[model samples]
Target: MPYPFRLNAVASLFVAIAPGAFAAEPDQIPQDMNVVIVSGSRVEHTSFDFPAAIDVVDASRIQDSQMRVNVSEALSAVPGLVAQNRQNYAQDLQISSRGFGARSAFGVRGIRLISDGVPATMPDGQGQPSAFNLDMAERIEVLRGPFSALYGNHSGGVIQLFTRDGQGRPTLEVNTAAGSDGQRKLDVNAQGSSAGIGYVLDVSRFETDGYRDHSAATRDQGFVKLTTAPTAGGKLTFTANSLEQDGTQDPLGTTWATYQANPRANEIDSTDTQSPKRTIADRYNTRKDISHKQAGLAYDQQFGDDRLHVMVYGGNRQVKQFQAFSKFLQVSPSQSGGVIDFDRDFYGADINYAFVRPLGDGKLTTTVGLEYGHSTDDRSGYENFIGNTFGQEGALRRDEQDKLKTMDPYAQAEWQVGQWVLTGGVRRTKLTVGVNDAFLSNGNDSGGVSFSHTTPVLGALYKINPLLNVYASAARGFETPTLNELFYSGSGAGFNFGLRAAESTHLEVGVKAIVMTNTRVNAALFQVRTSDELVVDTAIGGRTSYKNASATLRQGGELSVDTKLGAGFSGRVAVTVLRAVYDEAFGKVTTGSRLPGVPNANAFAEVAWKDKSERIGAALEAIASSNVYADDANADIPAPGYAILNARFNARQTWQGWNFKEFVRINNLLGRQYVGSVIVGDANKRYYEGAPGRNWMAGIGANYAF
Candidate 1:
């Protein structure tokens, strides 16, 4: 089928399943309309009245009958959001929102990440989703489109996880899970409240022998949270968490030929004259070790109709990694070697005050705030071979001290009167980056650069009736190059300070409505225009250099429908259609070239059933995505589009003060061979990351309350 026709068909299917297709049933209205969200405006408000696209994944959807290891397992149900488990733990999950962050080779960029009112993204706009503790998450809120600009820098979108607070009776819980390919997990947790103070503690360990060859990993994590109310209208919270991983093997991507021959096979090292069968990963022992620890404190006070909030946090991270670069590549004097070692220390704070009052015939709420963040990294690089023996660190080639700092001051106001709601906000941000080169034999690359921008957003909503709302929003945002993006120029020179930050304009129109009493629907149309957009100039042996492109355009539509289908059954569907392309030609990339790593269309659907007591349940899900390109020129063979089916069953029982639950899940029921993700712009043409054909997992949990 033609791409345009296929896209239109998907859009038509979404409309057919949405609420507008059915007649309204006022008497059977569901209570979900009362759900409250705390994103976009930083205040409690129903999503139905908000002038933006926002979705919430509740605790049940995140934990029930799931591995609860990777956030991608739950985020797939959100439209306009693409989350993939690369099956290579060393590299982390690949997540992108509305075509943004799709070109990232490792970790996450372009989007903002937050946990428990603390920023997870660094001041340089890079983030690690692996830092989130899924077991303790109460809910995750996703905000997209123009309203996302309110968060300041690199705000392509916003994802925030809120942890559950300890309350009620003291409880102790234990959970264990085992899955295909030697995957296993064990977790223990305790929570209670005493003397007006609440506390929660959690510990977990996970090990996997990976679905692909030469991939294995183990992870240990610990978390603690404490809460107290010291005065009449004052509350304080403290949270701490740590994650550790040692010797996690990295299975680099494979070429199309290798993937077709054997989906689980690693790339062979043709240059290894002594061992013809050895793979590049095995030759260099590509692996990573990581240690991360963080702590945060938050205080909130209420002064009648006004409120004040303050948060402070600090963290440290250490990483050592070995890449599969051949020894011959390091002969260049300017080369940074193949082994990377870095230790980072970061700290940040946020303070905000909100005032509520009456203006004219409407109620007005205003917020003013300041945010500051800083980070320093001690980094060094070395060759991955010693005396002709591969897999050993040798001969330091680079050393440096890198620092980043950011400050932002912003204000926002919202007014509501009768059937009209209006909102406006502005933020001014300044970011500074400095580098001190210690290994100067290659040349002194020490330098500093600063970037500043002022972003403004405006939104308006009209309530056509109690059941329907239409809104529009517009904003201006910007994203600066991360520390890693500044490491090398297109010509392999050090410290590319000449690179400029990308600026963007966003516009969106959306609708939220309840048509049939038990059915709710949300749809949005959005467009983004960017200048000085970043693109990969060259990528070799895990080292990538970036350059700015002329202009780019991204336009898309998202639709989501949720409904209770009666008789103990429910159904949900989410669909997205996006067109991302370069608006002007640059170098070898032509004007109409599609953005690499982004699919033109994708969708998810699910149907579930439960018994009256909610003690037994079952569900079936379908997921699909369109083909994706691997480079700016679209010259290589694209990853083929695919659809997969999954099924799960769960049971629960209660005895005395103890509750027990067990679940079993099977994914890729048809045993299909497909690429789960891609490494964009790989110089070696090793872009395909294969997904597992068929897999199964089972877990059991017991909780006792006293």
Candidate 2:
């Protein structure tokens, strides 16, 4: 994801500028407030330096919200993006920007996700980065479009997460929360520093009976970070974060007939949860379990006017799943003891360097970095009840695993003039892929390798004033074919290494304005052109092959207004509009076909009031959206549009009016019906009917501090 461009022309034209002699006065930074920024982009520093889009959400926005899970959940209210919960109790979700709403194979679409300045994506460029602790995060910065060259490949927009750190005296915190649908959450976080060493440890265990049948999910997450500053010249940081999850298996997308037969149960909802007769007649229950671990180390050094940073990180994940009843409809039923196991591991290193030099007129900043990593997978599919015992076709030994390794090198530079900011970056990539298929007659494994073009971007930021900024930029991004996409030839002609990489070009323009001392407005418009975009061929049904489309275009804009209401009452509102199209005459698709899965718009608004004296707080919010389609053809089968409203009220108090505090919260103030996921395959293959209707609960919680 290196962003390279023709900066010589811009630098040539920007030479005639003033010296240390500048015009603007000191930045009117909010005295006590913090500005969480997406690192790499100067957009966080000033709006005028880049003609692109960048968003910063402060800590207050998070603490007052009712979101659980990951950053996407917390950002569900943000404009320009859509967050969808699959409701399987797996911390399952889908978040997309521009025109990529329903494309949830792995996770977010064309968006680069980062945590604590480290890359949070799979080597194949497709996979969900597990949600770290949202409560411990200080702020989140989101940059939209291809111009986000600072971080390489999958260079779609970028999200940078920053965790809270030691501010002063050492402290310890403990909290617990529980609500309806058998929900409960317990958290403990502590921070302290001694002997030039600082540390933060956050741990949480959360569980829920779920809003629906077969929807139960539970997870335990913990992270410990240690930072040491040996001398005024150097700092070292070591971090270890781990997560364990187990619950109901994957939810099967069902049809209206299946739903009408049993509205409360899932395609695999367990009858065991009920009575003998009830379980004997019901066949809608299913279940799944998974675990993941991650750890890393980083170092930073400061030498006078420059700073140096280097980091190496990696992780491993495993999943165990079971499904039934569906076997009655598919190739075979996973009845009895039918189950599957999947395990994966990844470890890589990110090395980078940055320096600043003073020139005659102004200053020049340059950066170059190289990233190399290896990711491997060993999967064995075993059916506890394989063979005729379960009336299934696959054997007990049926299983598959894939191994892949990739190397990428990237570089970038930023030049500052009187009032203009110019920048560029680029990266080259090479990959090798191998697959182990139990059913294949070829060999134990099959392999293929290839090299690809670099992802690149260029941008400019123009600061009109201390409170006004405008920017624009263009970037090129590419994603290599994944293992399944390259070698897993399914029922039809399985794998095709012949498939090309998914590529994209993003163009953007936007402005940031501080309306007043207490309010701010940020907005941006973007259009992305993508070629060889991966799309499943449904015409043949179950047969998978990728076709390189001529080119698909997606355009959209986002607007957000944040205001400090003063007192303890504050609010914010945001809206987004997106459109996608692909005018290609291929397969069943004729010319002028709109892209499928992408939504037209997403909107959210919230209001909250807090009273420490009264020991009370309440918040009300709404998330609404338009319809979605199964295909660009816009046919009869479609996902309808829906809206949801949520309200929360919490009261806090002290025991002796000092030592400890307790609080209670009421969630799901209004219950509503909806659908969260729509997968491809069978005509009836659909995950339907969201959280059950009309259920409420209240829980008393306490927090201890030392």
Candidate 3:
């Protein structure tokens, strides 16, 4: 009776009729096209032949857009993915793919994040996007749908970033930019290749007097990469990155009343007792400071039809935050604290072997891999006040040691026939988590939980002709509870060992078409049924608790098109429509209610003009989305939909082996006021994070090649 069930029937019927409908005729098949993707299979394949819904944001787009501050700047057009800049540096960007990670209050969850073959996401499926250095990024690949199960746990989808390697002659470049709201940035980099070695190094600093009061922040980052060839067929790459933030303020969310009255105002204290109820956030000073560093090495070798790949990486992160909690909540002995402190060290290693051999008039490629990862956290909480002074660490309320380890072994095979590609993969994942509670004044609460699951995937891609390709896939995906979710117990102390892993069955069908030499279109229909879906119970004072619900069903469709409209003009469009709802009721939740933070519809379109010489270009873009509920109850609040316009202009010139470029961009071109993100189910009733109005940024850069 509902949309999910109806969509399911339609998708099944389409798949059943695909064979005969596509077998009518055969045309000359084109060779490898212009696009190649490695995210779908962990191996390179043509875009149309990948049998998945994947989008590639190339380097030109990344560099030309306003992505230096946030990745969402370049990802607004991607279908089935919602990337929003919260404008609050404390929590980073809020990203969700088809309702998978909409509940994350901080960082990313329920998705695997990879950068240059190294895992950016820890074993527990928690990731921080602040560590991403987009200034040096080459491209970003987003993969959704069934085949993503091959990446192991938390594979609702996968976002992989690939950085460019040094090539051609040596070059040095510098960039500087400034804009409204006191925003400024400076970046310097050098890249080159010589002999048998290639190197890239970059350093940057960003500072902004944010649009909201008391929201200014500054960040510094450094990155380095090196590649060398030792033996005949052996290559090694080393990478290191670091980030440091200072005075990153948290403006916090606002209630509906406060938003409509004064969007820039902080949360007010109703019980202050003073004549004028003053703002609490400014008085208490909510802020977060972070430092992170990571390094990794990868080695690759080939022997005839067999290839081996090995990678090892490690990182450390430290965080300290001051919250806006009042002293009344600290009286309870069970209360952790208003201030949070964390120190974490993580490391991992991966090894894979791939063999390509002949099999029955076709080629068979088999891959076997082993992955191991471990992480340890020294996490603690303290009162936000010491005597009469607030915003300082007081008495220690909680201290604990949390550790997680995971091991996964996987195997995959692909058989390429005349016009069909068949693929299959399986992965067995084992996870162990434990906690040692050090603060035992109240009681001794230390426990652990273990989770294991075997996920499998099967897929097929048929090339009906040079103009069309169709694909279908089925898989199983599993996600374990994140470390943060295991921190506090619902009733008493200790880790929530009672929490269960969320599992899902995924099915998808898709089509890719090349209508003309310069026009491309892609579409996909997908459904997922998840049991033991994690639902939020409460969120207060920067802490949240989660519990499992009975089941949820999510069904969706996505369409994207890119075309060369006319002479030197190009256009693109992407649309996504989805319905995610609880299939079974738990407590006060009713079945068929829409999922929180996930809109039913989203769309984006863009048009650009550029000369054949590529010396000048301009683009106009528009984005829109439907309303979304703010909580599971579906009655607390609703985040209204919005439409926004953005524009960009660029020009470049070359003189004496030196290239110079100037660019400018305007966001929220209409100066529209809107809510950019929501804090789902906030117990404090602070739900809406407001977006800034029209803003402009201009920059210039120069590079010299020798």
Candidates arranged by lDDT, highest first = 1, 3, 2
Model 2 earns a TM-score of 0.85
lDDT of each: 0.90, 0.61, 0.84
Winner on TM-score between 1 and 3 is 1
What is candidate 1's CA lDDT for residue 647? Answer: 97
Better of 1 and 3 by lDDT: 1
lDDT agreement of model 2 with the native: 0.61
Worst 10 residues of 2 by lDDT: 12-21
What's the alpha carbon RMSD for model 2?
A: 6.3
Give the TM-scores of the predictions, in the order they appear: 0.96, 0.85, 0.95
Q: Candidate 3: where are CA atoms >4 Å away?
A: 1-33, 274-277, 327-336
Worst lDDT window (10 residues) for model 1? 1-10
Give the Å error, residue 166, model 1: 0.4
